[model samples]
Target: MNVLLVSRGSTHHGGHDAIHRLAAAATETTGVPVRACFLDGAEPSLHAALDAVPEHCEVLLVATHLPPDRYLDTWIRRAVAHWRSTRGRRARILVAAPLATQPALVTAVGDAITGEHTTLDGNPGPFRSPAWSQITRHRRHVLVCRGPRCTAYGADHVAATLGNRLKEHGLGDDVLVTATGCLFPCNLGPLVVVYPDDTWYEHVDAGLAVRITDEHLRDSMPVDGRRPRDSPPL
Candidate 1:
């Protein structure tokens, strides 16, 4: 059986590299070819990774995360179910317990925290990428749900299309796009919630996402018939 390590990916380049390193270590330790998949904020998301798996291979899925995020656990199960049902494949997907639940983690943490080890006192600089030209100038935040349903339904494509459209229209500075966890309405995904206006759009696709960027993101005129009814602001 092949192994797949799923992680909560980071936007920072170094953070992403660390996840890759973790996957490599797992592969070395297990003597099995391992693949990496991200939860959010990176390419080759869990759905994409699953798609890359051969139709006949059984997979042992390892969540390489600590603290056991409930959202990730739920989404992982859902993604596996969706993959099996949609593909109608015989691949056996078995989920391993999260790394945090391993007894060795406690000892490892204890060993790492030696008596001589202590944090240095210093002021950390701005926690943002320099490539974000208008990081401090964002007028609105666009939250895209990257839940199981949303990801399976093409939320990644929606995010990419929305971002590109915003940049093409020179609205990137005004709007900041964020990949979020489940928005509570998984069935209505891929979903997007814009704030501080709190305008929520459900069942969004690349075309509808771009339309939102053009109408609501650009001029604050929310597209008609997309917003959820009676839903509170997010």
Candidate 2:
């Protein structure tokens, strides 16, 4: 049997790292092949993890979050069903209870608070790291529209590809990429807007998105043919 531990992934790196640690520990303790997967906001999504499972294998999916959520559980069920139908090879899937449902976890938390092994420092220190402040202090911010209509046209793929291109050109630190809802030109999606230059590009596919990152984002050269004239800019 194979095990996949699922977490609601974070935008920040640490949260995902923690999930990896838990998966490693679970494997070490049980000698089971274990992997960590995310529900959203990170790569190796639940579907991706399921795809990696060997065909005809019995698989167990365990949620790593505290306080079980009906929405997440329902989504997992639907995702598992979809995966079974879409993949050429199929695996037997079983949804296990979340880790936090264990009574030992509740006792451990109470013990941590009551046993006085924790500290509550009241210092009003820095909210974030200086390095974080530097990384976010970019000259240009790029917004990719991810509205329902845009998503139908592959906006998510566009955003991921654009982000990769920006990083490849060493512009990721200098450029901030944000995913937004309903940029208001659904027919022209997937749309990408760059600022403070206020340049808007419509119908951006992965290939065109890479070009925009290299030519327009890195070299300050806009592809005139792709821009919409009457579009509002940030």
Candidate 3:
């Protein structure tokens, strides 16, 4: 048997380091092969973890979220099933209950709050800063979804490719890119939403990202069939 600890993943370096450290500690403590996987924003995705599992082994997926995401708890099974069907089942995958469902967390939080932890002595600074107002004006802005489903569907590469293509086309000054969390209708994930036009693109890939950057952003022509027909007014 093996263990895969699943977290929501992090956008920063420290979070990835912490996940590996915890996985290593768990492996040493249990003598079971342990690995870390994420829904988005990092490498070693759930499918990748499954790929590394020994053939026919019983693999346990442990959900490590602190506050508990019910959506994740539900979607995980469907995601794994899809992986299994597409890649051929190599192991028996089982998902453990989320961390929040454990009764011990209540006691843990209560005990933690009792400790005298250090606190800041005073207000850090003014709410507003001059640097914030100094941002360059841009014609269009894009929000790329980095949520679980979108990540699994390859949003990272899409975002990277779009940025690179924009730079190549010398349109970086005219377009701004940002990565955001879950933008649902995950069925059409790897989504990219462009504004002030308010166009939402579905099932975006690296190639499509580049095309969108060239046609919609640079040439000011929206890509055909990106926006859903049934989309409600925003």
Candidate 4:
């Protein structure tokens, strides 16, 4: 099993550490000539990473934390296409979840890579286990939409405020908030979603965010809304 562990520059601290540890273990155990690639500040291209894998090798992508959805999906599709074109089939792509959350972006990446919806647990061999799973099973998730339009409307602050509020509520263990690049309906951002119900909210502000944390997230009440559909495929 020839392994390629690709780490992203933009992932959270915990996720970065976890990927490094996994890379070390995989190299030690398999002795399969593992190569580690760190996507540093948009400088290292995904195409270059794909090209780095040798022909006839069994490739596994260990995405401990992924970049924004726009970049992640484009890269996944390109990688799949490239592998099939050159290697005649898609490599076994295994993705570890992000450090904290379980937003639609995570689902999208998993779907794109594995062509399946199930989450990976334990040592899937050559691939390491996700770090977050050991701490707890049930985790609260907050989705921050930072798509091109949403970022233009100050989505970063929305993500920061939600993280602070979750900490303030002393629900850090139970909650994980993440800022994804986009969630479609760019006009309505900065949008937010809460899972496992997959509740979607539009035009979210600091006050509305706090209400979500208190009324729905903290209290376990359903926010009055239906789940939004995925964006139309590109």
Q: Which of the numbered candidates is closest to the native, going by highest lDDT?
A: 3
* Model with the higher TM-score, candidate 2 or 4: 2
lDDT of each: 0.80, 0.77, 0.83, 0.62
- Report the Cα lDDT for candidate 3: 0.83
The sequence of per-residue lDDT tens digits that candidate 4 reaches over residues 28-118 is: 8888665554433221234445566665567665544433344553455454565467545555555544433557766877878988567
Stretches off by above 4 angstroms in model 1 are: 9-14, 40-42, 113-119, 125-140, 194-199, 215-224, 228-234
Model 3: per-residue lDDT, tens digit, 1-234?
999998776647688888889999999999998888877766677877887887899999998777778766776786688778878876778888778878888888998899678877888888998889897799899999988788877886887889889999998788888888887788888899999888888999888898899899989989963555567766
Runs of candidate 2 exceeding 4 Å displacement: 113-116, 122-124, 127-140, 144-161, 179-209, 219-234
lDDT of 1: 0.80
- lDDT per residue for candidate 1 within 114-225, as digits (tens), equals 6468777786876776687644679999998876578787788898899889899988778888888778888788889898887888888888987899888898788863
| TM-score: model 1 vs. ground truth | 0.75
Best by TM-score: 1
TM-score on alpha carbons, each prediction? 0.75, 0.68, 0.73, 0.43
Could you tell me which 10 consecutive residues in candidate 2 have the lowest summed lDDT?
A: 223-232
Flag the better candidate by lDDT, 2 or 4.
Answer: 2
**Residue-pair clashes per candidate:** 0, 0, 0, 1
